[model samples]
Target: MKMTEVSFDIETVPSTIRYYLKNATFYDSSCSDNAKTVFVKGADGAFLKISKKGSLEREYRMSNFLSTHKVAPKVFAYESDLENDYLLSEAVSGEDGTSELYIENPNKLASVFGEYLSMLHSLPTEGCPYKNRTAEELNELTNKEASLNILTEINYSAIDDVIIHGDYCLPNIIMDNFSFKGFIDLGYGGIGDRHYDIYWGIWTLNYNLKTDNYKDIFLDAYGRSKIDRDGLTYFTQLIKLCD
Candidate 1:
């Protein structure tokens, strides 16, 4: 990781500039030890994210696609060396939902999150080049001993396809004084069930805040028109099994 100068937006000069490494691992949920996030502060006062090689191809692809029509951060540069791949992106400005600012308004937080998720699920997935297939996800759990018992519980009959964030937790979303900003960590993003993300949304809130109060409120705010309660339960159970 050299402190070389880099600029993404301006196209006239086209030269490398150094950036300061901020955080080595922005999130704690990296699926593999080799996969990590490196946050950097650019000379132009922008934030850029760099990730391990071989791990961010999908993220780069999906982020570019989402940035075109949604509130995703802009991609700057994606490169790789011998040991690591790098993805440089403009950071989503503002504090995350996990910050204390939202602590006073958990009800509003849950409702707004529900609406944001609803809008995300409403996006058309046509020509989308990725998918978070159940079978593929299940394979990620095969090595876990607890996953064996839950194997029989896997029901492939239900599917509500949409372009999902894959990991729809609080930290992945950003907000400024309770207003929505944008999304981050699109590594697991693809076409999948809306319930998968919803389950994670509820789980992340409860896990981070240490409360169960907002689950029902969020679900209610999300509306019942397109959600399947049984599907939610099933997907939640599947995630628990993996854990």
Candidate 2:
């Protein structure tokens, strides 16, 4: 990963499926892009972030705001594509949350992320009008019968009211040896319920960490009741199956 540069490589099955060059350029609808992209290229490298215009605007706001709140890549400029509209930005350096942290020393893992999530949750929820990703909203989003039954069985409001990553999975979080560098993909991040984030953390530590003790260690550190385990588990699945 290169810093203070506009070029970036996209990661995919083939290692690098594509790349973008960003150079303080704004959106342009006349370009050969239907998918809006923010392109920049500097001495280090180049990168392109592809997204719809609305999503690009939202991501730009998030990238700016989140950088101040936590760790996020900086934005040089953004513009609409010639054929489509996609957003782009400079890439930040660091590993995602799906690091060895989840596969090793779960107590340490939970303790580390537990503190971060707690810190985010402890913030005052004022002036933020975003709603939590509740099971209700999830149901409305998807109507597949197989998925609906699974969602209906679980109660999403049991342990609600925390700043959920919205997509609190391993990949969204970035870390380096128990050290949290920052978070990415804040598409769903907002002042929602803490349980949303905690549930994923708890589940990941327990299942991926493959430790029976993780459930207790996480609950103790997270300062929540184990009684909400069922809800957390159900909601975690619901979050995973979300479109």
Quality of model 1 by C-alpha lDDT: 0.70
- Cα RMSD for candidates in order: 6.2, 7.9
Off by over 4 Å in 2: 1-47, 52-58, 82-85, 89-93, 100-105, 127-129, 135-161, 210-213, 225-243
Error of 2 at 73 (Å): 3.5
Work out the TM-score per prediction.
0.78, 0.61
* lDDT (0 to 1) per candidate: 0.70, 0.56
Stretches of candidate 1 off by over 4 Å are 1-45, 141-156
Of candidate 2, the 10-residue stretch with the lowest lDDT total is 10-19
In candidate 1, what are the lDDT values of residues 1-243, reduced to their tens digit? Answer: 113334333221112323323323222223236554434544433344445558778888888878876668887767666655666677666767777777678888888888888888888887667865565677877787676566466554546478888889887787887677888778788888888899998988798768989988888878877787778777877777766
Best model per lDDT: 1
